[model samples]
Target: MKIRISWWWLPYGILMLASNMWKSALFLLLVLSLHESAHMMAAKAFHYEVPQVVLYPFGFGASILHLGHGSLWRETLILLAGPCVHLVVPFLLIVLVKFDLISITYANYLEQLNQSVLLFNLLPIYPLDGGRILLNFLHLFLPYCCGLWVNYALSVSLVLYLFHETAVLSFQIVLLFLLFQQLLSWLFIKREKEQFYYYRYLSAPKRIRLKHPFQDCFRAFYNVIRFEKEWMQEKAWIRRYFEKEDLKKRKQSHQIML
Candidate 1:
């Protein structure tokens, strides 16, 4: 799909940018834009269509389509591609700075951007790489519902864990924005449950949750860890329906070929 990058993202960013001084805002945009662009390019490389790029003050992201390839590994890799650049860019900048190639004027700023993107994006929230990867991997253990809860659970835990870290610039302020976005996203799911089949499908897909070391350790060692029966039931039924649908789709494809 053809992608559109809105010019308004620049003006809207003023609230974030202007506060950190125009320089901080500018650096923020530069770093986030590069990170998001890497995601777009990776999706395209994998032959998926990307149609929208949304830039925010704290970060920027893209709406990628056709990435639901049904394979846990594929989804995890795709989710990971974005953060790969975040890590790489900072290291390169550090190299340049260390070699006396780049001006020291940006030395502190670059360090902050490096740490910020690494710390922020790595937070185990649903849309974040860590959250996405965790949820997908959780699928192997049982139903999609369980996997989703696992994702949600991990996201929450990760956010809570992040509270102990105090080095990042404006950590609380940025986190508040991220937390607000997450709350609104959850609200969106709740309010539009029926309208969004994908949302429903994600948490309701049928699959067997395998016995991984994580699960074994959690249940065997931590009795406090648990799964919701309602989620498991929903996931079982969804998996069955998906299987039936897939068979029907294949049959249709065969008939067409004949």
Candidate 2:
């Protein structure tokens, strides 16, 4: 897979080294590498093609060639792999330190590094592993459009909360960058409805939760499907009815214009 480092991180790395935090910087890099490697390994194991690995200031990420690749369950496992590695590695470090194979200072550093990686990555913001997991889970129940909207809303909310809690200018700047990145992603998802729908159909047809018979399919096109015991309609049938109703409305509009 193609690998590239963000030039933006170069200055930050230099700053860390110049400030005598070189060991911490090195440990962060090591943890980030392992986390991303875990994702790559999981993708390969699932037979998914990983096209590129990008090294950002915070961490590294591997981009999977998503088209015709893995299922929702497969993707879930892949998404969880990075965090899973973070969960395991600290215990191993502690054991080594306990056995006097490694210094206690080094073990403490590694433990703190791993914990930071775990916490930052587990933030429920889209594009992160945690966010991806939440979105994928939402797609199982909500319509694709609805899931995207909810994801975007959650991202915005978290960004705002972070801004309120932090006085660190650089960290806040990074949060702002993430906010815009998520906004752009939200727009992209909104614009790619057809492609998204097809992928969703293939990956999660059986798990779709929009099983209710609606009074107006057009109005409910982007609505979340809350599972209710009163609704006896199958999701597929409801979706077909919505499609036909949409087509019928378009035809009527065209006839009126003619």
Candidate 3:
């Protein structure tokens, strides 16, 4: 997987060094690395390829290309793995302290860092673990598009709220700015995302039955389309959709010729 460091990280690291908090900075990096490693391990467990890992000032984020394309349960587990590492690290630190492998002071600092990272990651912001888990939960009841839109809305709202509450020129403002950038970038590719969703569904259609399949195909992530009391697979629906588009294009061409 490719690794990239965010531009924000350089300034943040410089500040930490200037403040003589190098130990804290090192511990924070260690914690974030462990957290992201857990996610990568979980993704591998589910046979998903991690294309890239981005290191932010606060934490690390991994891009699992096929995440959420298959079983929701597997996706949820992968997302949860990062937080679970934070939960377990404190205990491991305590064990190290007991064995004199680390000082009590160091252990305490690590524990606090662990708690802070865990809470921060659990915030409901898009692309964050908490936001993704919320999206997955919504997908069960809402259509895929609806759930994604809701996720984006909530993420932007929360980021805006945080910005308003933060002090001017504070470090938090930088983090919030980065998060807002991420949301905007994701929004710009909304159409591409929808097309990818359709392609994934068509390529590996799941067997899902619904009372009415005539509804919007993008409504739910796993609902099969039904037409005239017969269930239609994703391939058939996509074929029909393309055929309609082709017919429209042909008619337009004929009119232009005339």
Candidate 2 yields a Cα-based lDDT of 0.70
Give stretches of model 1 more than 4 Å off.
1-20, 66-69, 91-102, 160-169, 184-258
- Could you tell me the lDDT of residue 85 within candidate 2? 82
Residues 139-228, model 3: lDDT tens digits:
777666666778777888888778878786664765676577657746665564546456555555454655444434443344567766
Which structure is stronger by TM-score: 2 or 3?
Answer: 3
Model 1 scores a TM of: 0.61
The segments of candidate 3 whose C-alpha lies over 4 angstroms from its true place after superposition are 55-60, 99-102, 166-171, 202-205, 211-222, 226-232, 239-258
TM-score of each: 0.61, 0.71, 0.78
The worst-scoring run of ten residues by lDDT in candidate 2 lies at 215-224
Determine the backbone clash count of candidate 1.
6
Q: What is the C-alpha lDDT of each candidate?
A: 0.59, 0.70, 0.74
lDDT of each residue in 39-64, candidate 2, tens digit only: 88988998878888888765677777
lDDT of 1 at 87: 69
Which one wins by TM-score: 1 or 3? Answer: 3
* Superposed Cα deviation of residue 154, candidate 3 (Å): 1.7
